[model samples]
Target: MDVNGDLVHGATLTAVLDGSTQPVGLLGALSQAHRIQRLELPVHTMLPVVLRQLMLPIMLDELKAPRDRREWGDRFNRGQFSADELERLEHYLGPHGYGDRFRLFDAERPFAQVAGLKALNGETKSVAQLVPSVASGNNVPIFSALCEADELRLEPGDAVLWLLHAHCWDTASIKTGAEGDPQASKGKTTGNPTGPLGQLGLVVPTGRTLYETLLLNTPVVPDGLAPDDRPHWAWDERPIGLGCNSPAAPAWSQRPATGLLDLLTFQARRVRMFTCETEQGLRVNRVIVSAGDRLTRTPEYDPHTVWQHVTKPKKNQPHQRPRRHISGRAAWQGLSTLLAMDLPEQSDGPYTSLLLRQIGDLRADEMLSEHYRLGAETSGLEYGTQSAVVENAIGDDLPLPVQALLAQDAWLREALLECVDQADQAARALDTLNNDLRRAAGGDPLPRDKGSKPSAQFLQSLDRTMRRLLVGLRTVGADESELLERGQLAWEQSVWHAATSDAGLLLAAAPPRAIVGRTVRNGNKDFVYRSGKASGLFRARLTDILPRAAEERRAAQKEGAAA
Candidate 1:
């Protein structure tokens, strides 16, 4: 599919637009200049009935061919799949209908397979292996990608980050040619690009040593399934992406920032290849890509000292456990940095007081810190008391009646108490969100986008207020910006409140008897609100408390005077 998610078929030769150019250039290959031999179809490959009907007679007549055959009959042979009509297929029909048609995107990206850092054994080697070195039948000898740190231009001695691509083929050799030296024979045409030999390239950053290219294709037989097949499959071919390696491409070039989508598509394929591994016994564990670490013994050292030095949990630390480590931390970091920009938009939060409370609670769980690699400190918080942190967060976001309370001595205490009440309310609001988060943690992390939930009692109310305050920024109306802004505002406000207010004091206060303030239970993390005043000095009626109004009302009214 294109960037906009439109589907592309064989006929749709989507123009590769070069955004880096002054006027974006649509890439067109010089198909006329470079004549490619039309590859013959495999004898065993069951072509769709229509194609077989047309090509079978042609295949039988290799000795006597028509001159116009290259124009039409062998267009599919040369991998020219341009068509105006869509060819529907039903693999279940077993060639009664067309099936498994070839698709070529006409997009050839050159990726280098760089090698030759000193091996773990400290053996310095000159040779670097870059695989799939054949870029559209031309041997790529050098890569611009390896030449500089975020710069264009190629040079020798550049530390190149390359994909050690290992691609496997079902067939041994479709097209093999030789001319001069083994090295010289590279650029010269070889192997049939369009053949039964399906290729798979699993890429991983080189570790302590250059991995030896190995092919162990365990012929996989298909399972007849109306069945529940696990990830571990019975196979005719092994999950082998590490098939070959080559030196730097002779010509290196930068994939411009504008070509990020292309880069992502390429790398995502690499990720898929890397993740497909040797099938395990019954239960196959999925490989999740993250940072990569180096072997401590290697001369070409990398930071992963933690990975090397701390292979197991520390002594007497029950909380710590050995887990997965990244292969190339640096490479992974760089890759992730590039990919992060493409990630979906996220709401800025800590806007609603509820979120901070959740974060604080998550931190207290201890397991959360371990899961997220947040040592000791919880997410966004460190070393401070959680209660104090929550108190502060709520204070920053709470709207106090500043103008009305400014002259009064009792304002500070009253505002503080009000904040405590808000905290209690926020806690209840967080319940739905907490439930959702907990459900997510329990593994149902899907439906990447969600609708605006107006049902959240306290959170929704707070968001409404935040939206009203943020009316100046709204172009479409406060609802849109506020809806988005509230989450971030919540966090920011929480921070402001935490730094400036004593709202959390209400948290420790006993529950107010009847909705004035109260305790709300959430397992161990209980929100304690200040209890309501009962017949206290501050609760006196205005007539009883004030002399002037009290005397006037007393004289004007009967036994009961309005206060």
Candidate 2:
């Protein structure tokens, strides 16, 4: 897809390789030249995860060359993939790359497919089963327009795309047990885990162009690839159905990954794609899917996610876990953790994504231009009921400033954190006012949504202002101190106005009869509800929460007093 959303057919992987086109996921690639701005596709939980999986092989191989790693961004900007590098990359993703292993319909060695699995499983399921969004078995879509009766069909290319998607994000429903697998109780395997990527709120750092996006996501690992480190395609042996249990194809077990390469291309399911010759062409119609290798634990460096330090409950041990993405929350709301900014007095700051840290380093080194905006694309899956149902797909893209990415300047960093802190307090103050207003009305002091609606709106109203502040701080000729001061005041005023207006609206809607006064017995004393009393309390709370607002009010009062 181009910037105009018109699909350009015959665009090769080499085009993306040479920076001729942009890569598209849920959040499309940011373009410096403003060429390919967005790419639209069906919204599914596993699509982006599969896309990342596809890119990992090339990224891992590129990481192997130390000298080239240093100049990755520069080379990418200047028509990516040098003569030798492109050839090496072609050896992996090219049509003849890796021999027949890359072939989709090769009976002996299919791409990411277990050969002869249809015979081993004794039956085949529809291709719809390969896609998570389509209605299949117990995993039905609520909002999906298609029904089970709908005849689902896929082209060879679409089949391959969904084939990889299934392996990365298949639900943990009971599966058809293969003939020779001992793990199956009654011709079925139960208790399979969700896909590894399914368990994470993936944070992919996207750059201005396709090539830059790839380099930004490919963070440098201090410890180079281990001797055993190799992607699935480079493995000595291929998956041969559920019965074949080796280091490469560990069926129904959590195995420790060899290294980054192994983890990136981790096959979570054993799948076989079957095609039938239709009048149109060769159409993929059925599949056989079973369990495959699962990662023992989250790897230390996934380059694409933020990890939080956590402790196990039963064993009471400390470990780092990938932080889960919260549905409906914007990425900027998590600025503290996203940028790894140090909180008030906490010695250990948030666990930042390695990719984000790498971007910061690039900015610091002046490799990536400080003026170019960075995009942090987050993708996550919300699961339900033993991980059998796809509950929701969580995704958001935040166009971040370079300073926000680095957060190295002490004053600038502190100022940003302060604005975030003040906004949070102001929201909290608004919530308190809501409860007070409810009390004045002699109703339940606590509302069901807990004032989340107003608080969310308040924060959202500040989004544009915050981005502007970020841009202003980096303005070429502006004084840093003056910009900081003005930005802080602007943020405080915005918060104050939004919070106060929300509170005023709530108070205005209250019933006058209830707000006049109400007295109820509380243990041995009388508890009174009155609008006047709540109003006074709310004023105090707002003034305390928004000191800058209070200072401006004081200055205005002094001017009026002199008059």
Candidate 3:
């Protein structure tokens, strides 16, 4: 035959019984089948080459004899064989016809070289030899379990041998003259010559051939095989053919199936490893569900709902914690207002006395009393028991003589008197306001039964106003004393006006009585004359009598000290 201009030889056949064929015929058969055109050889080869190829299996059989015979003989003698020895013997017997032949071959030589002659041919030595060895050797009987046992039984040692043989057979089939069944090489390499056994019409079965042999020979149970009895390489599931059924499928046919099976198996193992039948598993499941729910579900409320719930007060809510009281500039403004109210101002002599009386009507009397009470309370003392100590001390009241001396320097006199007047006025106003505050806060009302009528609430309000006014006066008295000491009490007109108008005696006095005036002169005929006697007498009583009495008492105390 010729293919694509390459010369093709026909298929070559050999008889298992005869070791004679031409090498040309064998090469021609391979060429025709593999579509090979030329032979890259040193020379053309002939018949003995073919015969040698045919004789390979027989030679392999002969070589297998000593190993098998020795193994079987040892087992018969010893009653047991190690796993390795048993495996070697089984492998030796798998391809050969019978134990008798193996023994005969062991006894014979060059019989393998003889064509058309069986080593065990009609010899009585053959039957007995076969019987005992077959009975003793752990081969056919053990492997028979592959066909008979419901589940394949394999020992650990057997599994190791099975894997080893599987790999070996696969490797050997590729290399020429390697020791595996020639029939097993049928579809392996394209141009390879079939072995003598293959030519004798034996077909190699895939998958289980090696595995089954090992399973039968091994003492251990083949626990790994319960899931699938198929050979290790073919155990994977694959898609069945959609096309026509032809020759055996390719080795790669099960790839997709094997991958899927492995994936499923891995998932099963993971499930077994990670899952628990407890609350912990429930928590894990909840966490997974929560994560997935967050990704997929719509929110039920606005995101700010939590913040609003925290900040907003509910209906009928209980009272909240009180904030700290902060009195800043407004408190100062209140003080200022109280300071600027109208009260009585200071005057000289009996006029000073009358001014003091009018200031008392402004309720400064009550404010002074309250101030004294508060001071005594703070100091843990009785009112009037402690001597009055002015917070901002001032110079003693100026006598008329001292006043006259200061008046000689008009500017200095005016400054000193102005300070005195301002202090007195501010004190009166603060006292009045203090009294008013007390009244407003429902303290003791002023006496309406003393020939006058006023609402009790009005009286109380007046007392509160008086209290505030007195507080302002006290503040100004202290401040003005400081200014005097610092020498900064300049009499600004506006301040004077505010001082006199708000808290001076003018506010308390009645309009003066209108008088017709006349002039008098010592030498002139007609002069205006006026009598100022009553006012002069009153002033004389205040300035001379009262002060003279005080001086007399002080002088007596000094005399007593001396004594």
Best by TM-score: 2
lDDT of 3 by residue, 1-563 (tens): 11111111211232121233332322233222112222222111111122122211222222221223233233223323345644444443333422222211122211111112111111111111111112111212332323221223222222222212111111101211111213224322222211111111110111112121111111111222223212111222222442211111111111211221121111000000001134322100100000000011111111000010113335654212111111211111122111221222342111111112222222232212211211000001111112111111111110111111111223323433443344334433433333333233334324433422212222222333333432333223323545433342222222223433432232132122201223334475853322232223223332232343335546879999999
Output the worst ten-in-a-row residue range by lDDT, candidate 1.
210-219
Off by over 4 Å in 2: 1-41, 44-51, 62-79, 94-96, 119-121, 237-252, 276-281, 311-318, 341-349, 447-453, 460-479, 520-527, 553-563
CA lDDT, every prediction? 0.21, 0.65, 0.22
Clashes of each: 51, 0, 48
Q: Which ten-residue region of model 2 has the weakest summed lDDT?
A: 3-12
Q: 1-563 in candidate 2: lDDT tens per residue?
A: 22111111211122242334443321122222134432333453443554465655555654362333456556545644455655555454444555335566766666676766633448877778877777888878898667767768876656666777777777888877765456766667888888887877678776665555666666565566676666776766433432324422314466766677777777888787777777886677888887777777777767677867543323743356677788767666776777674322333235777677777777677777766767777878787889997888787776666665564654555667688788787777766666666666777766565445567787888788776766665542224676667667777778778877887887787789656868878799987778777767777887887787789989999999999
Cα displacement (angstroms), candidate 2, residue 121, comes to 6.2
Query: Which structure among the candidates has the greatest lDDT?
Result: 2
- Candidate 3, run of 10 with poorest lDDT: 286-295
lDDT of 1 at 396: 12
Greater lDDT among 1 and 3 belongs to 3
